[model samples]
Target: MPSTWTTTPVTAGLVHGALELEHTANGILPHRLPARARAQNTDGQLAMAESQPSGVRLVFRTRATAVELDTLPTKRIYVGAPPRPDGLYDLLVDGHPAGQAVATGGNTLTIDMSTGTVEHGTGPVATLRFTGLSGEDKTVEIWLPHNETTELVALRTDAPVEPAPASGRRTWLHHGSSISHGSDAASPTGTWPARAAALGGVDLVNLGFGGSALLDPFVARAIRDTPADLISVKIGINLVNADLMRLRAFAPAVHGFLDTVRDGHPTTPLLVVSPILCPLHEDTPGPTAYDFSHLAEGRLLFTATGDPEERAAGKLTLGVIRDELRRIVTRRAADDPNLHQLDGRDLYGEPDHAELPLPDRLHPDAATHRRIGERFAAHAFTAGGPFGDGTG
Candidate 1:
């Protein structure tokens, strides 16, 4: 006779790195942003990004030889773009990579990038099973897909389970754009922020919303209220690509954001990172658009549509944003010693770009993600760095 499976309720205590949990019709959906912050905005992009659960995971301890998870994933589909693979669920045992699985059935979110139109199609839940595990008590983590919105339906194991005890690691809360949201990275743990967190021996709370990190007031408030031992904000790329603010508005907005974060965490080690090297937007302004030129070939690429000549008029570009960010951090750091600034180029600069270019002319590929993660760990977590040892 087969061993009877024990079903466990997925609850808040069993989940890690999520700020909120919403009870859906089928199951629980983890959210990176709290309900209050989400209530303030109605942008579809932000909504989808937050629901994706970039750095969220299920954590427990058990002696089960086999484990199973039932999930309903809302997969994204671009009408004309190449087909995307099914979302991945990564399993870790005792802090080591154990296995990886993909849930089969789920809803589909069809997006027409050209017209900014979206359509939804419903599907059934998928049960992902992993067997052959060691039957000794050990910590287990099931990292949710970084790019897909997943509703965790149920968890089943051959043995009873309990929430894993705290690891006592420092919590690092990070906010950034799609790149930090694991846009092109292979898995949730593969995101640069995730990789860096692992290398730095810290817990991660990622607030990286794709194409939506516009320094919104609600986001700042969300950051302000969240508890974190270390904090970092990656700004500039989205601001430039979205063409959201001018130089005059940009400086004040950044200051206000930092001010909001400091409201809750006055002495936290906070690092302000500029955008990494993006040659397309380095000199040219944006309102980036899809290059439909190769649509016939099933290739979708992004291109800057803003006129380079608009720089004189104060249209934002990567170059312009970087300069202003350095100046702002310099002046602010004089009065606030805990605050620090790092050039985005230092992470993935001109030399790094020549080696590993962004796949879509905007987002970095998986290899570049690793490189950026390694470099970030070296910079921010080492001695003399903002979040380094001996720093408050």
Candidate 2:
């Protein structure tokens, strides 16, 4: 006997962790930022990063033994660098890792890092199929690639799939830089925030955008509007990465962003996290540049360009940002007891770095991501922690 297949239309209920869905010519495009927030910005990097679907997944319940999905992914290419591997899709059955696959032959975006120019190339859709699932009724989750911009074209399985029921867990909203956006992580669930969410027994809404976690007002508004029991903002890195602002503007910008978030979530458990240890930017200011000197060796690294003496002129550095964040949190916590601060070093400090040094002198590797996620779970979800209720 042959197996029968059923096609399911992708809807909002089936998509988790994305703020909005866009109807495209081929299929649906998931957007991390809502339409209003996306419309208010003109930065191409932000647009690309948000559409990458860092924490987005297609979740449902089914008894299907075989599943197939059609997607058109916009793969990224960097000029004068080694080609990047295809983005990976992680499959989880009944909350455990089951299988993984990658879709090929989609769109392409060729970028020139030095000149800031992007060229687009269109390609054909790719179908990803996964077979050999248990036939018993179980929940299924297809985690989209954390670093690829994918347009879901279709979903087909041997059996019907319906929206999975609520897990009765608290919702956690996290925002951060590329590290939190799953940069260099092996898969979508391998991102620190995703792993931490699982260990903490919470649902996650990740707004981690690569190279775009600056304290932007629109992002604050997006967080203000989203509903979450626990909220955290990982700050400091992108600021130094872009060398976007000075100390005079940085303080006020931080305050304003938090003020906006408080407008809607006054009593939410808010955690402000400083940057993790990045030796190059710990003391030196950035406008971080690629160390193309190793390009011939098929490796790319980052180096700090701004002088350390510029700190005296109020240029921002990781150390300076951490001190300022502590002061701001202490003063604010005096009145708002719900507000808290966590040092990023506690999550990935000097010792951890020494043991598992960053591969590119910037972003942590997959192993380091797991370590950071485990440490974060221990710190934030355990007893006596901000969001914890003094119980495991």
> Which model scores highest in lDDT?
2
Pairing residues by index, what is the TM-score of model 1? 0.98
**How big is the positional error of residue 182 in model 1, measured in Å on the Cα after superposition?**
0.7
Query: Each model's C-alpha lDDT?
Result: 0.92, 0.95
lDDT of 1 by residue, 14-36 (tens): 99999999999999999989999
Error of 2 at 155 (Å): 0.5
Q: Give per-model TM-scores.
A: 0.98, 0.98
Candidate 2 has its poorest 10 consecutive residues by lDDT at 383-392
Q: How would you encode candidate 2's per-residue C-alpha lDDT over 300-335 as one tens digit per residue?
A: 999999999999999999999999999999999999
